[model samples]
Target: MATELEECFHYFGYGNHLSNIHLHNKNALKVGIGKLVGYELHFGDFPASSSAKNCWKGGLASIQEKPGSVVWGVIWKMNQTDLEKLDRQVMGYRAKDVTVEKVDGGLISCRVYQLSEYIPAAPSTKYKRLMVDGAVENSLPNDYISKLVAIEDNGQTGAVDATLVDSEETKKTVTNGDGVHTSKAIHQSEGYFLYFAYGSNINSKRFSVSCPTSQKVAVGCLKEFCLEFAIKEQTSGEKFVGATIESRLNASTWGVVWRVDLTELPKLDRQEHIKEKFYEPVDVSVDLENGESVICRTYRVLQPYSPFPPSVLYKSVIVIGAEEHALPAAYIETLRSLPEGPEHTVGPMKSYYLEATKN
Candidate 1:
């Protein structure tokens, strides 16, 4: 008598589970790229009750039904024994039966697991890499793969409690599509805008004093602009100084990009003394370290005077901010090597701002 063969079922994988090397290691066989309709991929954590809750940091990929949405992933052919291996490997996900469309337009009933208790969050960089690698291996669409690459991750290696993540109210962060987060706002009729600061405002502490909503996102380079201490200020019965950017060939001004709420525009304008006409906000494209360029609002001295060295305290602030953002070493060295202007008597307002920036 012939023995009965075990039945096999299809499995849809949208995240790291698409990795054939990993899937095969777990005794599962890969089919090919498949599509699921009415579902979208999101990052979230495992439920508290699951032993695997501690596996993923920040967030992991999971599917949720959204009308008119599509999720692309790999399909796997696995039997009941392989299914047990998959369940053990994916700790917090509960298996759900769904219909997926293969490349040939054939519909197959598949098993996909989603986090049992979904909490919106970001994934870790390593976790994201696995998903991207698997997507590439399975020949997913480039546009769909780009979306996977755009998912932000928590800057961690292991799963962490959501409470431990910084609250959005405290510091708003926006992704630059390269896994970097920044915060700060510039003047817009209404809505958040990116602000590029290459001067003393590069200092987060100083920028926060004026634009409290500002959060440093990514370090960006303003090409064809030279950083100069040419913004002359008259106070304390003497010549004071600030930094500015001037158009120059083959020049690059490195600074921080901040995403800020529109409500902080007035505060930023006042800090930059827009009414005084000391500096003018200009729209410029800034190239980020991640090989992407963004248009940002930055300030240029309205009438830049001859080069003047900044005060020791002021120069220190710029240098500190540069170092904090890990700007080019040569640039930081140049800033440190520059001569300091004559010291001006510190005033009450200057003292207040200096103190505010210390925090």
Candidate 2:
């Protein structure tokens, strides 16, 4: 019987390329010592280890490291059967879970932590200084401060991409001391509004490359909603629920909200792929400081055309930094009461829109 790792490699056209098959006790931990045999390795996150470097070579191998380990890497050559086996094994691994997909004429696999196994760690405060990368330095527009805040607070790792950051010279020419005004001008003279985003975009720096003027709002509640969306073939057709920030009477969610200029709304709309006939904007009340309230527009799929049933969509709002505050129990229960879709019904999916509840 082929091992799981072997099966995964084969399914993705790497079966023959894999040879050395090595498996360590799932819980073993040593810097480099372990079973070595026909195993193929891929290195990420762990850079300096010799074992990680050996993975690039297609063959059998062993590595020795520390004892009483909590993570193990499975190395092997795989065919279709082997890939399937690996898939099953990966699903069983608690600390990390992975799925494979075909992309750009090749198979790619992504590994991430399972929700139950994920633990929030202390946030990093160190700012990355730009030294050698000219492209990166040139992209830091005057608004880079806000962009930096977004990136740091969101826990994103990586240098600011050129597409997102403008050069210092550009910043000097664009702003007359006001960052928001420069952003507004670029957004084309439209009224500014806030957009609350919790998921992938939380790494605000990355998100800012796409929306430079957005701000990291400090108030809101995290709401989990069953949203039927698809990413590049990587997600394996699994409909995942995403958390969004909302406002409630007793508590609020924390999240990054973009103070977007109206002119840029059209571009954002295009990016979100919102169409008038398929979606509509609805008003949502958000908690403000000092016992005040602000209404914001959030887009939801209209009746009949949505893909998933409401029961699966649990709405939990995020309060930007307040991960401790639980969303209203009533809101979660209410989501459970929503109806499910009709046996995988298909139609044009509804997209979201931006609406300003205030002037």
Candidate 3:
């Protein structure tokens, strides 16, 4: 798009806009990674008049002029229409013309957005995840990625709120030609229940394999519950461990909460082997990062086995899922500290789980 011709403009994305997924969804063409000199990234408060405050309930990212500072971001080549769409999406930001330094030591003129007036604030976990994942996706400097990861959130989980939702959010259910509902958020509003996942299901890709109709709502913490790899499964006459949680004094288990519709309950139940009585759904109160608690349905082992280590592939899925969702680094380390089992499980999804960690 932004070739030698003048029909396109280079746009530098430093925040959640850095996500290629987001850019692609907006129909913007990603060019490459670049750096902006003398400008530093800042987490600024959403203006009171901006609708983003109601939707996000957290800080917003912006760039501020600062000497001797550099901000790394992805450069997207967008036409005039795409630029207009971007402007509408970023409500309070204003575009400014600037020059970006590409990796090949080439300078490119670009459009960068910034807030006219900045008020410092913390970002939400969801927003931080977007930026970190984008940085990793574009292979930005590891130190810069670490800096983005290290920034703290304001404790609001960026879960969709019914009353304060975006005006553009789908309000009606629309069925496609295949008879499948096109919008998952509409189901979330009408016939969905909260499901908490503390194991491998926390990874979006892994979770999608089993529960295609479900949508992640937020990250939650189940207090007084401790995670253990004690659910043993026999495959080819060998035992492999699976994850389960148990009540423990003063312990907390971090996990993801999903919004699942009643129609897909059968599918989820089948995956958990509900008919086989391997796991039973139990109701528990999961505390969200927004300081609110919600009742959620989660699975527990029906027959507890002796403590066993999980297979390397199994452990990799859980750890990768935890990291993929940008869960607390300390909790991820705890997952990483787990020892691998003697043998890997042979299952339909085994290859899928193993392939996920390579990225």
Q: Which candidate comes out best when scored by TM-score?
A: 3
Clash pairs (backbone) in predicted model 3 = none
Per-residue lDDT tens digits of candidate 1, residues 1-359? 43223467778988877663332334567888889999998888765655565444668788889999999998887776666666765767789999999899999889898888766788886577567656754668878877876777765532224343333332333322122222223333557888899988788777777788877779999875688876455433444466787654457889999988877765776666555545556556788988998878776654535677877777778888888889999999988898887556222236634753464
Is 1 or 2 the stronger prediction by TM-score?
1
lDDT at residue 214 of model 1 (Cα atoms): 75
lDDT of 2 at 128: 16
Candidate 2 on 114-136: residue-level lDDT in tens?
A: 21221222222211111101112
Q: Model 3, 135: alpha-carbon shift in Å?
A: 0.8
Off by over 4 Å in 1: 1-190, 231-239, 345-349, 356-359
Question: Between prediction 1 and prediction 3, which has the larger TM-score?
Answer: 3
State each model's CA lDDT, in order.
0.70, 0.30, 0.71
RMSD after CA superposition, every candidate: 17.7, 22.2, 14.8
Q: List ranges where model 2 is wrong by over 4 Å.
A: 1-190, 198-203, 222-254, 276-279, 305-359
| Candidate 3 minimal-lDDT segment of 10 residues | 175-184
How far off is residue 216 in model 3, in Å? 23
Off by over 4 Å in 3: 1-4, 20-25, 49-54, 160-359
